[model samples]
Target: MSNQEENINLPLVHKGKVRNVYDFNGNYLIVASDRISAFDWVIPTLIPNKGKVLHKLSMFWFDFVKDIVPNHIITGNFEEFPAELKKYEYLRDRSMIVKKANRVDIECIIRGYLAGSGWKEYQKSKTVCGIKLPDGLQESSKLPQPIFTPSSKEENGKHDENISFEETVKRTGKDTAEKLQELSISLYKKVADYALTKGIILADTKLEFGFYDGHLILIDEIFTPDSSRFWEVEKYAQGVSQDSLDKQYVRDYLEKIKWDKSSPAPELPKDIVEKTLEKYTDAYEKLTGRKF
Candidate 1:
């Protein structure tokens, strides 16, 4: 076997939001760091164990719902991780060992509520990514059923644009497009239903999929606060926007800034950083029913 054939800690190919993807022989070792990003730019501060919490939460869902669908999780145990990462075992729950697959070029989005780009698209065109909604739907109103809205996975610093299903088929092949849509909606509904029962309203989420061999598998994080909009069940109601358990506070702060929302992201204030960390911790405890 070549040196690269044996599991070795190599260089990283991509870093996004809270995770770092490093080359580990033929497989990849994805390390979940405590880093956070808002408005598509990575912020300055770390959120103590945020990566581990996110990883643990996703692992819980993967196990809870794997019977419903297959995923790409190779291993989450530190003992099985590459030797170079053993010192970071304190964050074992956040990192994952996964086969590096050819990631689908589209971002598979599922929306159960009208907000974010969905809301903005609806307000202007009375539709979101080519899916028209019923008239008179208020902000944050729940849809009768979840919808699969695909977006472009742009290069760094570029915004992901919501594309029609036909457009998705154009970018990815027709067969792959059909599979992604089916799998995305299936997983979203299963995970969302479970979260609802656990007092967390999974308003909406984004999932990325990839092809490993001939199988369609779920890649990246599932329904973590960073990837999904989570709300407290007791406070959620139709028509009214409730406080999100995720990084809404951080987003709100960023919105108030004068930056152009581009590269070289602004440094978040200490107080804002602290509050954001607390929010992540609170969501970890609330959704997982355990302390971080």
Candidate 2:
């Protein structure tokens, strides 16, 4: 079924690049779509089964980290869904029912490697998010330790701007800011260590948090290819962009074509879409030890 047309009779709360959120009894139903985005633009083509891979991987990670932090998930199992939602069989493996929380407007980014915007920033100032790093670091070099770099989370069609730690403190106040840093680092360390055991490098990940009844809880997707950079340990290299099992492949393809960012995004070739789905599926299987 085409996710774009599968209207669930629920009140639409948000329609993001790759997910649609619905209001359900004071809660939210987040449906991961087959849609993919790169270079901040939503690609015209959809990757088959991409949404299921993301949903399942997120379920795995949420369960894995429940001991470390409370999350907004109420349930992801379709059979357990409220009776009213049962007719939408399409949501079975691609949707999650979660508590409604006041979303924190900051992107809680934890970088354990020199890559992406962090690498670009480091090349110029030897610092990422204003956190000075040791000199001589390469493109994909691992940092001495993970650092909490926060960003202002913008709405769809906008870019998230990285901010300093002090800026985070000013925005969130001292206590909430410190708590976000502590939880973000702890979550990264635990998951990165686990990913290494499965022969994948959890390069860096972006996290989101929200306030639930006056308490901070993890919200949004965690550790999925769309939210994290996953590289095969076998292909690890320094000073160069490592082959990644994530949407970085899509980003690379877009870069190679030299598509100017201002124009409407172009449709991806068949091969590109298939290969992109493969990378996401591979990450899901490798990390979850289950067939995608």
Which prediction has the highest TM-score against the true structure?
2
Per-residue lDDT tens digits of candidate 1, residues 30-81? Answer: 7777778887777777666678778888887778768766778899888776
As a TM-score, model 2 comes out at 0.97
| Candidate 1 ranges beyond 4 A from true positions | 1-9, 82-84, 88-91
Clashes of each: 0, 0
True lDDT of residue 52, candidate 2: 93
Candidate 2 C-alpha RMSD relative to the actual structure: 1.2
TM-score of 1: 0.90
What stretches of model 2 exceed 4 Å from their correct place?
1-6
Q: lDDT, candidate 1, residue 250?
A: 76
lDDT tens per residue, model 2, 189-286: 99999999999999999999999989999999999999999999999999999899999998989889999978988999999998999999999999
- How far off is residue 26 in model 2, in Å? 1.5
Prediction RMSDs, each to the true structure: 4.2, 1.2
TM-score of each: 0.90, 0.97
